[model samples]
Target: MKKRGLAGEFVAHLFPRVVRGENLRLTYTFCLGGLALTVFLLLLVSGVLLLFYYQPTTAGAFSSILFLEEQVPGGKYLRSLHRMASHLFLILLFLHSLRVLLTGAYRPPRQLNWLIGFALLGLAIFDGYTGYLLPMDQLALWATQTGMELLGTIPGGTLVKDFLLPDGIGGSLSLLRFYALHIVVLPLAMGVLIVLHFYRIRRDKGILPYL
Candidate 1:
């Protein structure tokens, strides 16, 4: 109780400022932010668990996935959960983008934050594509191959094709690269963008027209 009081007193003494309801965007913005954070955390945890049992190359991936789903107890549940959460994350990411567009939330001081949101949107979709390739099932193989062909038609696709389906791609190697990108590079980039997003919010709030 004493500690609680001291903490509260410290907060009060150091920061007496109050947030006015009208000063912020509509309630929906807060709701959207909540959805974004929830989905991102879901992806992080599920992606980590998936990396434990998955192999990336074409030959072994199918068997490894089957092993996780059938042989390992509770593996089916987590794999299914991960798949569902991924779809949900994409849906909500799209919704968040729409919310910003409709609200004109990118005005003036918020324009750069809007760009960050767009980048996150693209990353979310790319994450889905990368995940789809990890299983190396017939569906994964055909879909990825078709995607590569489609990109191949576009200019400068030679560079893009390397990472999408490198020459040495097989079961274990591709999975490792996919896992590292999903868990390491993409997440790190997302984290940095999220921080920047919040920092910009604080900066904009200072100059925003108060109601």
Candidate 2:
């Protein structure tokens, strides 16, 4: 047999050669993790498309969104798809986490994968929150301000708030920071965590058998 190349080996590692028959049942896993991943992919594509038109500035952010919705063809649908997928991704992650917990899938060798999954969920939530401020609308402005205030109330969270909003609130610098985090930093981190999560799952012998 020909030895697989690096790309082929990586693909094989992700796809795996064997899946137990019991794991095929829908009720066993509810496919929540798979669904979340699908939504993440959707969000990625739509977000990239949106990036072509989005402006990362307090002065132009909301105007650019309006231009996309009213001037760009099919832009409204693309934005809506991304927004809906973001919401669905979070929901699916929560349900998947609950399923893992109830099934005791986090026990033993699966613990590391569980931690990775938890971190991915957190990144997803923060990604959504960061995106919330990119539009620079009144709702987004007040909501982010409220969140920043709440963060200041927590121990050590004030430092985080300061780091994120160094120039007070709702300015060009803060909007740019949120835009960078939403579009670049958070997604890249989540992507890395997802790869590690999958590798851990395979190493741990796949998902736990149904009870």
Candidate 3:
């Protein structure tokens, strides 16, 4: 006696007719993934708001951030929230990953999902790094130069660093590249991976019941 409508079916698929350990208390079961997802959602909201005022140009980047903090209403709060959320998101995800490892949830049918989670972690870190450069302050400039130097130390990474920082660290081109990746490519990739990660969890019968 399942209902049969497009929207209903979609919702049903997401919620599902059954889940493992449904009778157990939620706090007693695994919920780190959900916590990580919530923090990521917060980051998304704050990041979108920040996009309205952030300037990607090397010359304007720092000034734009300063103006936001000093002039725009609630801008300082939003920026701080965004930055804090970035750190919290990573922390939660790391805990989630560690929980998975400690609970044996990364085995067998769940290995692929673990890999997807790792992909998300990598993308999130890269996104954070790119954001770090958007402010174009002296600290950001030095940090960016150090990052590029580290990248150059890799065998084939010099080409990528050159292409991304053609005019060197703190250059307009590098700033623009980081801005695009921060605001566009990495976010999109992470979004897709997140969807896949959750889908796999739902399909694989949730978080394996915390051992």
Candidate 4:
């Protein structure tokens, strides 16, 4: 209990001072950013809960999802929350960026944070797309194949697609690859980027005021 209390204190201490001050307020300053973070935390929890029953194989992927929806306790609710939270996170992230842009907070030292924010947004979108394919349902399979074909239209797109789907779309290799990225690689990158984003905000003394 003592250790838990210490950890809580450490996390509490990590919050940027600007969040504690009413004087630093803007119309959408804390609301959008805080909501984005909150929704992401929900996604993380629900995603972890999902992993216990999820199978990443071509044959088992869709069946596992159905099992989750119809069999496991609270599985349907968790899946629903995960799906909705994914969509909501993107919306709130975009609004957060819009708020920064409208406030001209992207100036000077904050420019790097803006770039990082954009990267995080792109990764967030890609994260959602990759997770969408984990079910291996008809919509998921065709949507992913269509996306790959679209990628193939670009220069070197075939090479990229070959690398991603070396065993071809709808194959076990493709499913495994997407599963790894969805559950591991992309989330790790996002976690690093989020830490740096908040660290910069605290380092810069807070979000910049209007120009």
**TM-score per candidate, in order?**
0.79, 0.90, 0.86, 0.86
Count of clashing pairs, candidate 1: 7
Q: Report the number of backbone clashes for model 4.
A: 0
lDDT of 2: 0.84
User: Which is superior by TM-score, 1 or 3?
Assistant: 3
Candidate 2 residue-wise lDDT, 105-180, digit = tens:
8999789889989999989999999999998898998999998898889999989998899897788888889989
Report lDDT (Cα) of residue 70, candidate 1: 95
The root-mean-square deviation over C-alpha atoms between each candidate and the true structure, in angstroms, is 6.3, 3.2, 3.7, 5.0
Given candidate 2, what's the lDDT at residue 48?
97
Candidate 1 per-residue C-alpha lDDT over 1-211 given as tens digits, one digit per residue, 9 for 90 to 100 = 2322433533432233565666456665555655776778887898788888976656667889999999998999999998988888778778878988897888887899899888987887777777777777778767767777787898899677776556534446555677577768888888677666655655565223331
Q: Which candidate comes out best when scored by TM-score? A: 2
**Model 2 segments beyond 4 Å from truth?**
1-10, 18-20, 208-211
Of the candidates numbered 1 and 3, which has the greater lDDT value? 3
Winner on lDDT between 1 and 2 is 2
- State which candidate has the highest lDDT: 2
Quote the lDDT for 18 in model 3. 61
Error of 3 at 30 (Å): 4.3
lDDT of each candidate versus the true structure: 0.71, 0.84, 0.81, 0.82
Stretches > 4 Å off in candidate 1: 1-30, 168-176, 206-211
